[model samples]
Target: AAGTLIVGGGQAGFQVAASLREAGYADPVVLIGDEPGLPYQRPPLSKAYLAGKTDAEGLNLRPASYLAEHRIAHRPGTRAARIDRDARRLILADGESLPYDHLVLATGARNRDLPVPGADLAGVRQLRGLADADRLREAIGAAERVVVVGAGFIGLEFAAVAAAHGLAVTVIEAAARPMARAVSAETGAFFRAAHEGWGVRFAFSAGVTAIEGTDGRATGVRLAEGDVLPADLILVGIGVVPNAELAAEAGLAVADGVRVDAFLATEDPAISALGDCARFPSAFATGLGRDDTVRIESVQNAIDQGRCLAARLAGRPAPYGAVPWFWSDQGRHKLQIAGLAGPDDASVLRGSGDAFSVFRFRGGILRAVESVNRAADHMVARRLLAAGTPLTPEQAADPGLDLKALAT
Candidate 1:
């Protein structure tokens, strides 16, 4: 008998299963994953994994012995076909069903498809899961020139890795700046320069029209502006679409993702959602004058949400109010951001030189801090934001005042 049924074996699902055992709610926690391997972290897929600095063994979040020792049933290469909400059971792909007292949906998200004319070419790839990363890694090594569509974090990160390996890398983006949706323009410009300094070319404000291929192999990418960029390999990194079809089919309220309450519970009390697949009421303001739904795609968000949902299932219901944080690794720059800043916010620079911090202010209140190659400042920003301590722009800009001390 399965005590808890977790759908999707990514980071969020694995964390919840581990947390349930840690919280002493052990009966039989079973994790069903569609992928054919152990649960692994996705962040390293674009960075160290592609750089060959770490192998598959290093990517596993937990060893097989740990799961076995905890008596957690790990089911890989298994897909959850559907959910019978009334019966509280999950129908598997192999014509089997598992009943659960509590269910956790960590279905995560999949890479959005590039609907261009030549998207189906053999050399075109999208990096999202572990398998995708493995294929891209192989392609990157054999290809001389790589054209990346969309200048988001994943695209830029992969470009940096390819450029570091002396491969000709060109990043095409529809927007004027990279990561315009997530970071401030200052931070975006900083990364653009950093990647450019490392020999990565940028095609800003360029939209890809199609991927030109010969004999089923991608030859180059055709832009909307009628320019053909020659490439032996192409990677699509537009964004990701949440895997919320399961929740929607089960009649749960679905907007951008599986809709959840403050406690990470869906409309159905017995079911919960977390990680990228979940869009819950955010604790931070989205500049829309009210709390809106947010679907964060970061390791920190997944881990924190997993822990919070597990605590709720353990009968210690707590509102998920974690300070949203994110990080991106491009070349030698370790860009870290604490708190979410809106487009209307004002940015202030604190330090000068290779290492500096950018403080985001909205209506005289400190909203976020973006640190570049400054680990210490990033740590302090996380602590200060978590404590809800107020820091004005003047105080934050003071060069002599230590951020860690002020945060305390």
Candidate 2:
């Protein structure tokens, strides 16, 4: 088979194949994925799916017939062993091989393992894909005390779900505050207060030393301070490591991820990478006074990058320059972020109570906005950032100011 070969049938890979067909590119597109079943949306895996609000079928991006109709050759439950860059070939783990005119290494990222004792015990889980969510859903049903390691979006989202079940949920974080690396201190304080109000406990500046197991089942988590948090189920959401080993082993430059340019193209013109696996230059990063390259792990980034790459492959080239955005649904409240921001960015407050937006500025330039239960502000923020619209700190702080009008 020739045409484009997409290695990883996640959102990014599927988008590329779909977009190529939509763009009327007459080529035999093949998408090989390691996960069994139709390609599905992952964001819901930690929220609605885990909370029993949605099922596996609801998670799919499209129906099975859509792939066939689009002429996308879906190869599920297949693994790519390595790439023969010299020959433009992809070797499968099962000793099969396929050649491609263009290759997309959208292999995505994998959950970083908790390197501690008794981590592999039963009842200890981590949510990344459907299987993990299913196991966790079962484990959560019979668990009373639930301890979540890592205070990132995944952990907090899981905590919200567990706490909703009336379970005693405690979140342990190495950082001084939850989501410390992403949001401003003020925003973190707001969420911390909200979580505490939900009867959810938090252990800040903490580390997990080991997982305590009894009868080959996780019973608790031992902290570094020699304190054990008794639990029937433990969920580890520390972070993820980019699955760029396949690209690296095949002689592609990989730092934290597969190195790509603003066009989302690797050094070799024949190959490209995107999603969580490719670290490409981002305009938002430069505007936020940070490094140019950023590898985002949101559904927005994957879809945008896939569409951008598809345009390029369709003979209409344009640099990938979409504004970065993300969201987290914690119980009744929602947190939305638009654009990239650093720790040192200035924070300005707007709105009151649970409905507010934290505007981040760097060098007097609006960089990012963190909206809590303020969808209107989040929507306007994406436009403001994408268009590089001028918004002053004073203006952002003014509650009476019409942000929607300004953005328009």
Q: Could you give the C-alpha RMSD of every candidate to the true structure, in order shown?
A: 1.4, 1.2
Error of 1 at 169 (Å): 0.9
**Model 1, 38: alpha-carbon shift in Å?**
1.2
Instruction: Give candidate 2's TM-score.
Output: 0.98
RMSD of 1: 1.4
The 10 consecutive residues of candidate 1 with the worst lDDT sum are 283-292
Enumerate clash totals for all models, in the order shown.
Answer: 0, 0
Highest-scoring model, TM-score: 2
Model 1: what TM-score? 0.97
Per residue, candidate 2 scores C-alpha lDDT tens digits across 332-376 of 889999998888899999987989999999889999999999999
Any residue pairs clashing in model 1, and if so which?
none
- Candidate 1 stretches greater than 4 Å from native: 286-291
Report the Cα lDDT for residue 359, model 1: 90
